[model samples]
Target: MGTSFEKVHDYMGRRVRGLWQRNGKFYQQLLVEQPDGQVAPRRILLKSTTLDNCRIEMAQKRGIRDQGEAASEPLEIPSFAVCCRRYFDFHESLKHGLKRQTTIDRERWSLNRWQVHFGHLRVNQVTRVMINGFMQKRLRGGRNPRTVNIDLINLRQVLKYARDCGFFTDQERLPTEGVKPLRYKAPVRPLLKDEQFGLLCEKADSSANRSGPILADFIRFLGFSGGRYKESLRLKWKDVSFELRQVTFGSDGLSKNGKARVVDFNPALEAHLRIMHARRAPDCKYLFPSPQRGGKDIPASDLRGSLFAARAEADLEWVGFHDLRHFFASYCVMSGIDFKTIAEWLGHESGTALIDKVYGHLAADHKRRMAQKVSFSLAQQAASPAEQPAVAAVQQSPSAVLPLPTQSGESAATTALAS
Candidate 1:
C-alpha cells in the first residue's frame, strides 16, 4: 500500500519477527508496529498468491532481520523458503475424505511438480505473469490440454483453500480466473446390431458349455440393463430384486457418485437371472463371483478376457464394454424414448450440455418426428369430422376391413368384409 519504500520503512520501524526452517523450507512471522502504537503479528507468509506482492513490500521497506535476535542489533532482510509441507498439510485437512485417495494423490503430484519448478522462490513472489509462464512451460513440455487443465484445477483449489484460511489477505490476489483449457472430442463407439447378437450368442453358448452360465448371464445383463461397467461389475446378489424386476445400485455398491437408482429388467434378462439365482451358491455374496477365487471380488480382467474370446469366436471386432451401454441408449432413442428417460436410465447427470454431447443426434431426430406428427395432426383436424370417425373405425376393426384369403392363399375379393 506504501507509495515509496521510505513510507513502509518508517511504518514498521520497530517490530519483532519470528523465523524458523522445516523440511528444508524457511518461514517467517512478523509483528508490525501499528499507527496506534499497538504491535501485532499480522503474518505475511509468502505463497503462490502473495509471492510477488510480498517481495515488493519487503524490498520497499528494506525489511531486515535482527542479527542477535534482540532489540540491540540492526535489521537485515532474511531469506524465507515456501513451506510446501505446510501447504500440503492444510490441503489434506481441508479435503478430509471429500475426495478419493487417487484424486488426492493427483493433486499432491500437481502441487509437487509446480513446487519443484518454483519452490525456492518465496510464496509472496508469485505473480500472474510467472503463473502464465509456468503454464507455457508445461505446454512446451508436451503436457496434454486435459493434464494442464487438471493441474490448473488443482492449483486453483489449493489457492482457494489458502485464501479461506486467511493465509493471504487478498482472496483474489492470484490470477486463477479466465484460464481456459482445451477440450478434446469424446469417442463414441456404439455396437452394431449384428455385433450385439453375435456377442450374445457366442457368450451364451460358450459359457453354457463351460459351466460358466454366470458369465454369460452377466454379459446379457449389461446389454439389457445398460449399466456402467463398474456398476455392472460390482453388482451384488442383494442389489437385484427379482420380485420387483429391477436391479438397484446405490452408495454401498459401485455407484461412484453415491446416488441410488434402479434399472428395470426385461423378460429375457429376468428369466435368465431367475435361472442364475437357482443355481448360484447359497453363500455367495456377489451375483457374479470369481469362479476360481472363492470369496474374492470378480476379476475385471477375466471378464475382459471372456469378452475378447467371444468377440474372436464370433469374428467380431474388439469393442469396449461401455459401447454396449451406448448401444442400449441408441436403441431406446430409436424406440421413441425421450432424452430425459434415456438420461435417467444411463444415470447421466442431467443438463443440456450432456444431451448435446451424448444424444444430440437422437434429440434432432426426435424433433423431426414430433414436427411430422404435429403437421399430420393439423391436416387431420382440417378435414371433415366424418373422415376422422371413418379413420378411427377402420383402425378399430382391421379384421372387419381386411379381405379374407381364399383356399388358394389369395385374397377372395380385394374388398372389405362386414364393418
Candidate 2:
C-alpha cells in the first residue's frame, strides 16, 4: 500500500498526534507542514472519549489525505445573532469604560432590528446584495436614510467583531465594502422666536405636571448654555463657578466627546443658575435633579409629556427640547457670534464644521439688518470728497467752468470768476 494509506502518525505533509489530558480526555493535535517544511501544531478537542476512537478518526483523516480530499469539514461561521452577542460582550469587557446605558440600549435596538432579518444567516453569508436588500426594505418601511444608516453602522460593527474573532478570513465576508450608507439631506431644525419661546415657557410653567416649573427652567437653561440634553442633565453644582461665570463639563460629567470643556454664561444665565442654586437641595449633586427623587438626576422621560403639552398650548407644536439648543446657536449666529465661539460653547472638538453646516444660515431679519448697516456705511464713505470723481474731473479739465446760478445782478461767467 502507498505510504499515504499507512497507519503511521505522519503522512502527506500533515501529522496527527494523540494528546491525553489530566482529566483523562483525549485530543487530536494536528500538525500542518509549512511551506519551509516546518510543522505548525493546532490542537482540536476530540468528540470521542476513548483513545482508540481518536486513532480511528486519525486514520480516516489520513485516508482522506491519501485521496487528496480535505480531511475535515469547513470551519463553521457564526450567525449574525451570535456575532452581535459576542460583540456586546467584548465591548462590555473593555477596561476603558463601556458606552453609556442609553447608547448600548440604542445599539441593542438596532441589532435587534438586524437580527429580525439576518439572525439565521452566517456572518460570512452577509453580502452586498443582502445589505442592499436590507436598505431597500427599511426604505419601504418608511425609515429615513439616516435612520437606516444607523442600523447599518451597528451591523458593520458586529461584522467587524466577528472578523476580529477569526470567524472569516475573506475580505468579501464583510458586507460594508461596496455597501454605501444611504444619503439624505437633513432638514434645518427650526428655532423658536423670542415671543414663541416666552409663551412656551409660560405655558410649561403652568402645566398640570408638578414638575412643570422645573421643566421650564430646564428648557431655558439648555437655551442659554447650548448644551446637549444629556450634558445639561449631568451638570453638578461643583462644575459651575459662580465667580467666573463658567460651567465646566469634565470627565466626571460624562460629556459625549469624553473631553473637558468650559462654557461661559451671560449675566442672565449666571443669575438664573444662582437662583436655582438657592432652591437646590443641599444633598443634590445634580443641577437638574428629579423632583420625584431628590438628589437624583432628572429622568428625560419625566419632562417629555409636559414639554409636548406646553408646545401645544403655545401653538408651537413644531418645537422640541433640542430646539432650545438650536435656538441658542441660531441666535448666536444671528447676533454675529463667530462659528468658532459657538462651536466651543457646544462642546464640539472638531472645530466649526458642525456650526457652519447647521447654524450658518442666518435669519432673514439678521441678513437684512446686516445688509442695511453695510449699505449705510458704504454710502457715508462714498459721499466723502476724497472718494468723489467730481474733484478729479475738475482738476483734470481746468477749462471746465462751474455752472453758477446767475446772481441777482451778476452774469454767470462773472459769478464763476468771483472765486
Candidate 3:
C-alpha cells in the first residue's frame, strides 16, 4: 500500500474526512449500506482541484448517495461478519451468486455458525490456522466431511469478498488455500427390490384400517412415478390427465427444483392413478389426503410413521420413501428406458448426469440380460476387409439366426420354394 496520499483540506484549513488528491484531482469516499444491509465504502471521482471545489463536490455527492448513516470516517476494511453480511446482502448482484434458494438458505445457515466463531475478528485477523482448527472441531463434533465443507465454503466466501475489498492483494496465501476438502463418501442406503416391493404392498393391502388402501396406493404411486415425498403429498386430482398419459407436478414449494414438471405415464403409473381416482375423496383436492382428516380436507403431511409400521410388519423395516423412488428408476431402466428420459421424469436439473451417476449400475442378472442383446460369431473371416466391417454389425445382431456366416437362409420374397 502507498504510504500516503495528498490530503484535501476544507476552506477553513481543517483536514476533510475521506477526501484525497492524486494527479491534481480529488476523490471522495462515501459510506453506504449495501442492499443486504451491510455498510461499505464507495469511492467517486470528485473532479475538483481546489479546496473550495473539493468541499463543494463532496457535500453535493454525499447528499445524493448517503442515506441517514453516520458521517464517513477514514475508510477501514470492516470485520469478517460485516464483509459476510455484505456479500450475502448483495449475493444476487454477484456474477456467481447462489441461484437456488435452498443453496442460499444452507449457506446462510453455515455462515451463522461461522459468524459466532470469528465474528469479532477483522478481515485480516482470520488466519489459516484458525480455519484448520475449525475444520477439526467440526469433524470431532460429529459433522460429516460434506457438512464441515459447508462451513469451509461459507468462510472462504467472506474471505474472498474481503480480497475484493482490497484486504489480501498481490497473490497472498488464502486462509483456505492449503486446506483440502475431505473426500465425501456417500453412504449407501437400502434399495427396494421386486420381492420387497410386493411384501410392502401386501402389508399395506392387508392392514385393518381405512388408511391401509390409501397407503398402498401411495406406495404404488411413488414406485411408479418416482415422486419425491412432499411432491406426491402435494399432488392434486386436476394434475392428472389420464387421456394424455401424463401427471404434472406444479411448483408448490415442494418440488426439489422449484419448477413444474410432468411425468409421462407408464402402464403401472396409469393403473395406479386410475385406482386412486376411483377412491379419491370428492371433498379433497390432494391425491393423498391426510389419513387423520376425517371432516377436514387437507393433504397428508407425511406417511413415515405408517410406512415404518408397514415395513415392520412386512419384515422390510429398512425401506424408505426414497427406496421406492429408486425402485421406479430401476424399474424403468430394466424396461429399457433411456436415462435422459428418466431424469426428466424424476425432475432432475442435471439431465442424465445425476441419474447415470447414481442409478447406472444394476443387478448382475439384469446386466447379463442387457449384455446378451449383443452378439458375435468367432468362426469366420471376411472375403474382403471393407465388406466385412459394413456387414459384420448387421450379422452380430442378436435377432439374427444365422445358418451361415452372414445369411439367415430365409427371404420375405419367397417364403417356401420347391426344392
199, model 3: CA deviation in Å? 1.6
Candidate 1 ranges with C-alpha deviation above 4 Å: 1-96, 106-116, 119-127, 130-143, 188-194, 200-215, 295-302, 305-318, 351-353, 363-419
For model 3 the local lDDT of residue 235 reads 88
Q: Could you give the candidate ranking by lDDT, starting with the highest?
A: 3, 2, 1
- Model 1 scores worst on lDDT over the 10 consecutive residues at 72-81
- Candidate 1, residues 1-419, lDDT tens digits: the string is 23221212124454323332333332344665432347665434333224345445444333443332332221221111234455555556874346555566777888787777665664545566767788888889998877877887877776566555444555347556666665745455554585666566566566533424655666667767787776676777888888788888664633656577877776766887788788877767677776665565553335766666666666666566776777677667666766676677777776435655676787677666665443345654664654555444444553345435677764423322211
Question: Comparing 1 and 2 by TM-score, which wins?
Answer: 2
Better of 1 and 3 by lDDT: 3
Instruction: Report backbone clashes per prediction.
Output: 14, 0, 1
- Identify the superior model by lDDT, candidate 1 or candidate 2: 2
My TM-score estimates for the predictions, one after another, are 0.60, 0.70, 0.66
- Whole-model lDDT values for every prediction: 0.60, 0.73, 0.76
Best by lDDT: 3
True lDDT of residue 170, candidate 3 = 52
Encode model 3's per-residue lDDT on 1-419: one tens digit a residue.
24355777766888889888766667787776643467777565666777777788778767655554443331345677887777777776666544455667777889888778787787777888888887888889998999898789777877887777677765777778788888898898766888989889999889876677778889999999999887788888888998899999855644776789999988888987887888777899989898899899888887887888899999987789888899998888777788889989998999988887887775344776778655445422623444444346445674544233327654421222111
Q: Which candidate is the best by TM-score?
A: 2
